[model samples]
Target chain A: MNLTIKATKNNTFDAVVVGSGMTGGFAAKELTERGLKVLMIERGREIKHIEGYDTAMKQPWEIEHRGKTTNVSAEERWANSRFWGLGSEEVVNHLTNDKENPYIEKRPFDWIRAYHTGGKSMHWGRQSYRWNKQDFEANAKEGIGIDWPIRYEDLEPWYAHVEKFVGVSGQKEGWDVLPDGHFLPPMPMFAPEVHFKKMMTEKLSRPVTIGRIANLTQPQKVHTDLGRASCQYRSKCARGCPYGGYYSSLSGAIPAAMQTKRLSILHDSIVSEIIYDEQKKRAIGVRVIDQHTHAVTEFFAKIIFLNAGSINTAALMLNSKSNRFQNGFGNDSDQVGRNLMDHQLGSGAMASIDGFEDDYVYGQRPNALYIPRFRNWGNDKQTAYLRGFGYQGGASREGWESGVNADGFGADFKKSLTKPGPWSIRIGGFGEILPNPNNRIYLDSEKKDKWGIPMIVTDAAFVENDWAMRKDIIASAVEMLDTAGFKNVTSYDRPTHMGLGIHDMGTARMGRDPKTSVLNAYNQVHDCKNVFVTDGAAMASSSCVNPSITYMALTARAVDYAVKALKKRES
Target chain B: MLGGAFSAPTLMAMNHWEQATSPTIEGAAFSLSDTHRKIVAEIAEMIIPRTDTPGAKDAGVPAFIEMMLKDCYAQSEHLSFTEGLASMEQVKFLELNEAERRGVLKYLEQQTKEKMKAMPKGTPFWRLMKELTLLGYFTSEAGIKASFDYVQIPGKLENIKLKPNQKAYAY
Candidate 1:
């Protein structure tokens, strides 16, 4: 069925947000509160907040495979091979099924994504950290790629704005690389972690802070007003938190946007392209295909925001080719699909600590300890690489799985396993992959998905710089453990593949020059004033920290600019 | 090209071949007869030995291993396991008469440490037997409560240092 709705003179809304995930949710909430009639389009099925997480409350024994992947479930694994979360088998429908819609990986790139109403915001690790001043000014000073048109100062207010609403729990140590944020009370460190932190700070003269996460260690007014409660400390967050303990688009942004009553969300509407009017020289509307009926429809808006994630947003722009912009929409500079980047991880060390057998953690802590970036900053330059990486790790006592080799059958083995096993510490580094033009994603017209849209061909890979950093990531971790006098210190570097970090960014980068970038300082398309791409695609550089919090701040800032531009047009 | 090479039917046939050739314990050995398969399954049960908690058989461990060997294990793993099973049978025959299989198993337990270290990590029969035996035994109601302290809903965060008297968690 083909459905067409003609836009009346007054039918156009103040804004149209293309996704309902981390950035899109923030966009909707920010714009709606600012009095914009925001229409949010989500490609996945609608899910009600607590009710949607079917397996969230289930115990380990309750699952059929006991969290193990079965043959039938293994077939669905390819769809979300890019993502890293448990219960993925039961929640396969929320992600893009690779069998139905496969993307070509010229080099093995795991483009893990969840396309549902909440997008990746539902599955995000929730480790929220602010990008220090160095992160914003690095590209400009180092003369790699383009400078971030907006600096830390420009985003500081917005960061404060979003952090208060999001309820980030972290202690303020006033570190230069990691700035302080308006935070709820920090979750106390486990005993082993406290020991490690003391050693790192005193011995290495380095700061080791508890993970600055978007989890509520203490309930604040914003969360309480929204009818959300504190974390039950279950640590089963990726399965989806019914308690609203962790921040997700479903629990936080969407509900807040809905409360404004000016925001409308439409699910299962796969947006094909932004309808750019050549005569008006602005994005007038968007064309979408109904996922269920395969019916084509059109919705008009004065302003269009593309928050369909990095690859999807870039593909949409490339697919939206017209006579005026023949190569692709907003492709005048030909930079729409270049400079794709993601953090390279899967390189770290795990060692057994012989002592501390008597110590065991009380509950499963949802967050890990973070070692902020100490290398290649403030006169501490490395001969090998320019940018640096940070470590996220923790120590935990072994459980029943530790008794795999131990001898015994009935009562003896049972009695032995009641206490915790030896304490072991493991740390993994999230190193920045520089914005090289060679690392890119392109539209493969030869291959089409189930939606009939051309498949995204990813050709990105880690270069020598990333490999060089991996060496330090392993060596430094071992050195720290050895210096701390932990016995049996061993380091490991697991072979890492691209896209494993799941923090893909920098495809449609923001820059001052239209010739060098697709989006400008305000996240607006350099060529099209009315179009904005506020998701990871607009990132100029991939910082070592988790990118979700930055995405939220950028989205809030972009919507503020877009609303003002819309008002100026009206006046 | 890779997809074309391993069509669904071909993959399934390969899986069945691997399963049919895999080695088994004295109680459970690979043979053409269904009765032989049943005997092997029973022997697997004896190795784990059912008690208050569900044993290897009760946890469907033997069946799970059989299915895994057929579907997941490589051909080399199947051959190695089969060889191990044949050796076990030879040892049992030499050690005692038909009624002395349990006695032979008891002797094998004494030599388990050296024998297990000699076996490779990926051998199908031994690996599956070991994994399922542990999984089935531990996840059983008796295994969880009696063997280890099971905490279904640990409502609060404590992060305590374990005392000498503290019981181990069943996680």
Candidate 2:
């Protein structure tokens, strides 16, 4: 199904954005807001903002299995079957069926995904934090991986810009480790969390504050103008917030992009390849495949933005082989799918508190208490690891789910189950996984997925640096809880494969030298300057923080640069 | 404020969840005999007997337990569970008085404690019966309304003092 010149001409736009997720949503908004006619091609089906959140309002009783998987779902979602609560009736619709979208794992890796319009933004943990000045300099100072082309100063204003629109709710602590952002009033912490925070600061000198979440506690004109409101204090955020309480691609940026007349979108369209013109020395357009019809179509544009997540974005570049990029698109250094990194989790501690028995919560607060990175900082430099880690956790009384193990039977047992159990607090560390060139993803041509594309084989694994940090993560957590006078403190460290954190980054890293990285300072492909990748694919190093907010900031900055470059050329 | 219910965006948002076929309904291969089903129901009621609030029987937990076991469990597991029930039937458990039935359940509970590692998330027969009863009773509409505190939308969030004898929040 080759397109004629007339049809190709009709399909042209000023710019094309691929894979509408966290970054693509912002890219479309930024480009279209600049009066550039942008076309967004999403492989997943379209879902409208508030209305698409079908399970958002569903109560536990409304679900057939009462928020657990049925026999059929347990088999269908076998890959993610071990992930508790993922196959529940309310939350399952927002996630991708792992059986359908298959990938090869050289080492055990969990490829959790959401392929709809908003992508995983619909189901993000919503813990937002900035990668501060220290984070940008860690690689250069340690001489580990290649230096990041851009610094925190380069993204400061862009962070402020996106945070204003995204409506982050956080406490502004003047710590150089984690920079402050433009935040709404932070959500209230639990009483136990408050007590724990006091003890932590007084004893351990670790700053414990409320998590800087993406949920809006107070909606400003910027958010309310887009028809989004404050969070409803309902903890069921993962099902997609009908009130537009928290930020997602569908609830925020995509709607804003569509509000402008310059933005057009096509759904169920997978971008197969980027059309690079050898003579023109730039990307002219992209070739797309219809997800259902298997029909091929080419849409011409002056510039292209690849925001198909980290691994998928690299897979696309590797698959888009041509005369200029025979190895892969702009993969002159063979770095299109290398240096893959994610935050090393699966290590932390939990304890039962003696107090807070008489205390209970009024609403289901969806946020957690954050103990920011204290190690390897100004006053507390650590020999255990190079970078540091932060803790995201909450303290609350144990609910009825713990009753399965509790001893009980008739009326007495039934009456006991009606009330809460012991007050327990749990915290997990999100430690930094260093960018090792050996920890990478390469496309397996021999094994094609259900889509007829090459299955991405993840050879990435946790290195010695990550393991060292994990030791600290567990030991530090136990020490803190024990010192705070908590009862029966227990630690946990499960075997975690990469991609479990879902903050996949550094696949197509941005470095100063074209010989070592795929993208440059402005998030553009080093050789193919017209094509940009502002997702996690462009990350040079894996900082110990949630990466979505950074992706939004970088996408906004890159779009600003790209639009100006286009204008300069036009003039 | 959900404004403009008839607006273009609202109309587009009407894209409901596509997969409506209940997984249990679509793939329920196991069926319990009437005698086996009654004994299962009696065991569930024994585990969570009706007090002031409705027990497992009133909450329609017997049916839920069967549905879970039928569709959710493997054929081998279903056979194993039914075979365990046959052992109880062999003892003429249904003909016993209430006190005798309670004593028999206490003995099975002790036996289950010793052999719990044999079955993980899926379970031994007595443990499975008890677990299913608790799960079905707690999550059902009857349990939520009568036994637990059902708050549809608590608009405010805070750490508050617990009221005496306060019911657990049905999340």
For candidate 1, give the docking quality class from DockQ: acceptable
Give the chain B TM-score achieved by candidate 1.
0.53
Candidate 2 colliding pairs: none
> Could you give the CAPRI-style class of model 2?
acceptable
Please, what is the TM-score per model? Answer: 0.88, 0.93
Task: Name the runs in model 2 displaced over 4 angstroms.
Answer: A1-9, B1-30, B73-80, B117-122
Tens digits of per-residue lDDT, candidate 2, A1-571, equal 0111333458989999998899999999999999999888888877777678888887766777777677777766765655667777887877777777777889877677778888989989998999889789889999988999999999999999999999999999998888999999989887778888889989988898899999989999988888898888888998888888999888899889878877778888888889888899888998888878878899989889999999989999999888999999999999888899888787899999997778888878889988888888877877867888999898888776676766557778777888877789999999888888888888896988766788889898887778889999999999999888888999999888877888889999999999998989999999998999999999988889999999999999999999999999999
Q: What is the TM-score of chain B in candidate 2?
A: 0.77
lDDT of 1 by residue, A333-356 (tens): 888888889998887777777766
TM-score of model number 1: 0.88
> What lDDT is reached at residue A458 by model 1?
93
Q: Which residue pairs in candidate 1 have backbone atoms (N, alpha carbon, C) closer than 3 angstroms, thus clashing?
A: A362-B159, A418-B167, A418-B168, A419-B167, A419-B168, B23-B82, B27-B40, B27-B43, B28-B40
